[model samples]
Target chain A: MTEEPFRWLEAIANRRDYVQQQIGTGSPVFAVSLEAGILLLGVGSGQSKVFEIFDRQAMAALGHPADIERVRQMLIDAAHLEAFTRASADVNVRRLVSFGLSPQLKQSFEQIFQAPFMIDLLLGEVAEHPSKDVLVKVNFDGGFKIQHGGVMVAAPKPEQVTLATDWLKANLDQKLKPESAALVLLLAWNSLTSGTPLPEKSEQPVKLPDALVEQLSDKVVEAAVLERKGSNVARYVPLMPLLTG
Target chain B: MNTGIAGDFLGLLAQNNLRPLAAESSTRAPEQTHATTVFAFRFRDGVLVAGDRRATAGNVIVADDVNKIIEIDRHSLLAIAGVPAMAFEMARVMQVSFAYYRRSQLQPLSQEAKVRALARLLRENLPLTLQGVGVVAPVFATVEAQGDKVVPRIYFYDPLGAQFEAVAFAASGSGSGTVRSVLSFQERFGEVKPSTMTLNQAIRFAHNVLTVASEFDAATGGVDPLRTVWPVIKVLDANGVRDVEAAEHLDARKEGV
Candidate 1:
């Protein structure tokens, strides 16, 4: 086999290895960012959640902890839409119902969040009271939380809408659950076909200092590049429970 | 009973010269930096947690695909938007703390308890906040209790140990100002209820919101909707987390959206 091809395969292995390591460590969080173009990680604990940042040796110029600290903070902190999932092993049927959620919902949430997973809730719900403040109205007693969103979707109409009608009719129902699903599909589809083109920048531009980049593998860099370019990306990833398992 | 935080768990870690990297109350970080954004909003029937995909340092876009949200426990969501390392470290500490408690108590921490746990984490990060590299504030939301159906909920926190619930919407981020403006105005235009509009409509609404946010919020960057690369949306209904398919979003979008 060609050395280049072998190296490419190795790159793929490296990406999987990174993900596997994160999974094995029981972090219980996996994130796929359209902008980041890769699976990002956040570690979950009962008290709080922690994110992971890799410092490249190149960033030695910026000073040790400071440079890495800045990058780590930025890596997990940046995003427009983020999802959080929390769950417990214990099931409290009573607590579940009080929040307007079905026992099933509670169970599902518990099963999901209870284990380990983090998703960006691009969309969800909220309730606020003058005195009570804004609270998550959905009562998830022994379950999970999953949140997500898309980057940019188009409002295709008339010609494009009609043109795409055939595609819709053909691929409509390998799935169901309605409304939300439809929107995701269209927006994703539209973005893939005719999304905004990215502006050209420094290929030799302000490279993120070599040292800082080193903490991450080639895969991380590749993913970041795609995310930066604004490509319409999608994947039906299992929550952390399945990922970790 | 003892969720992660200033309790014995942290105390024990302290004995070993360890500390939380994420909470707002940990010791002061040597330097102050990193920005995290936690996005949450009300959906037709429940609440959502959507975050930006970018993080900044001074003026640079330091990281993309940063996972700001953390699963504090099952059915609950937590996110931080502060000093990167400590915020995340504390988040991990608290996660392990929660698990320890869950194992010890043989039950998960209560939503209220989880809040308390985070408060403790913040309390510890106090020194750091004072120093400059503070984990400072984090946004936490979980399904506390729904009235009849699977209702969504949201919450925000302050350094002073305040957890404020938000109605309509709440946000934190670099381009938050611009994105918030778009969300506020768009929300004002009208609502597409989960019951009224199909799930597809909900996804479209989400996409529409994201598009608007991206236009204004530089942190959120992506291409317009296209084939294949649909945003994978999840719906929290009577049944936990349901993956909102792309076709449905499109169908809803076409249906008068």
Candidate 2:
């Protein structure tokens, strides 16, 4: 049997695909899990939804019964990713990188999943280090590529080389805040699924206020609420925008 | 020391048919010379790993100068807070294992790999931990180079061998409760952000926390300025790991800077 981590990722992807097929259109979901915090955004069938990612039961359905407890613990850990983020709020991104799955565990996961588990880390500027932000992408094949002042895509080879690359380059170049990053990713996904021309530039840049962004959708609002509740202190504000209208 | 072994150090140990001392002991005895109070947190430059120099046997203090913080490698630090002997042995095995990996693979083990290796070792010693002969909660950390930037990471482990990657800070041992309370209070109300603390501030904060722990917990030791015996304080970052000297520690306390 495959390892729990591998099984869990596969199960989530499979379930996501099933959801998209059932809705009869592309549901491009983008998720970022940091420490125990999770942010998931989905655009499906002309509607955008923001919600939490996988649950233990959903994962259990795809794997062995005995592995349920272990998988549950792993998911619980993932849920606490935000707490970790909050705790390390003063830390530079370089030190934060060490607080993830070990290389040995990653190897085990890769062996079981038959693909590399990619890590795309976005690091902010540190005073002692260089002034530039960095995006480090570790491929599934155990190799990694570093990008300074560029974009990264994790889709299939064709999409990554074609549509995704074009959209990111044309639309995104400047340093992006969390909300802007989420917006750009969602917009890119919409363009990819709809085969619409990538916007070369915006006449009036999209402006999303923290309060209005919080009221985007129930799913997005819930995500924000959950994050605030989990930390027991309001440290993180999940970017939620009403894109459906 | 065994030679002519292949693969990592752990693999080499298995090849030599060697089992941990805990695995050999069938009769469980409640031996409790446990070390206490160790933690690590990220600072401006890298991560600061600190531990009080105290070990206790039941109700009696056995050693006051026990160095609980062990440097596992150039980039990695391990702070153990349980059975002193077991913790020391675990640190030794980790050092050897890491060296073996580097020697064999011609490259140092990544921070993640070091964390996992230690976790597995602790997991294998769980039986002893359960028997109260080898209970150890450890914080392992390292600094890595990503692009031109250096990142410091910290991980906390349980007696069951479960590894947790602490995002900003982690604490373990007998006085861990007190230490954590102090940390939480600082995070909630402290003027400086815990993650953004400078090296001097982090060292001072750690000292203050350990001093608080020493007040209530007999096993936890406080700073001894007169004796020049302070907590084992070390910092790991882009420059490398280095122990905070006694003189500097004394100066920090005197100046309150």
Best by lDDT: 2
Per-residue lDDT value at A112 in model 2: 41
Error of 2 at A185 (Å): 58
For all candidates, state DockQ relative to the true structure. Answer: 0.01, 0.01
User: In candidate 1, how many Å is residue B155 off?
Assistant: 0.5
* TM-score of each predicted structure versus truth: 0.43, 0.50
lDDT tens digits by residue: candidate 2, B1-257:
22344335554455446554446555647557989999898888899999998888888888889888888777888999988777887887786566545533435787777888888888888778776677888998898899999989989988898988888889999899998888878877889967789877888888898989989888888776677688999999897778898876876787573
Total backbone clashes of candidate 1, pairs 3 or more residues apart or in separate chains:
146
Index of the highest-TM-score prediction: 2
RMSD of each: 24.7, 16.2
Each model's fraction of native contacts: 0.00, 0.00
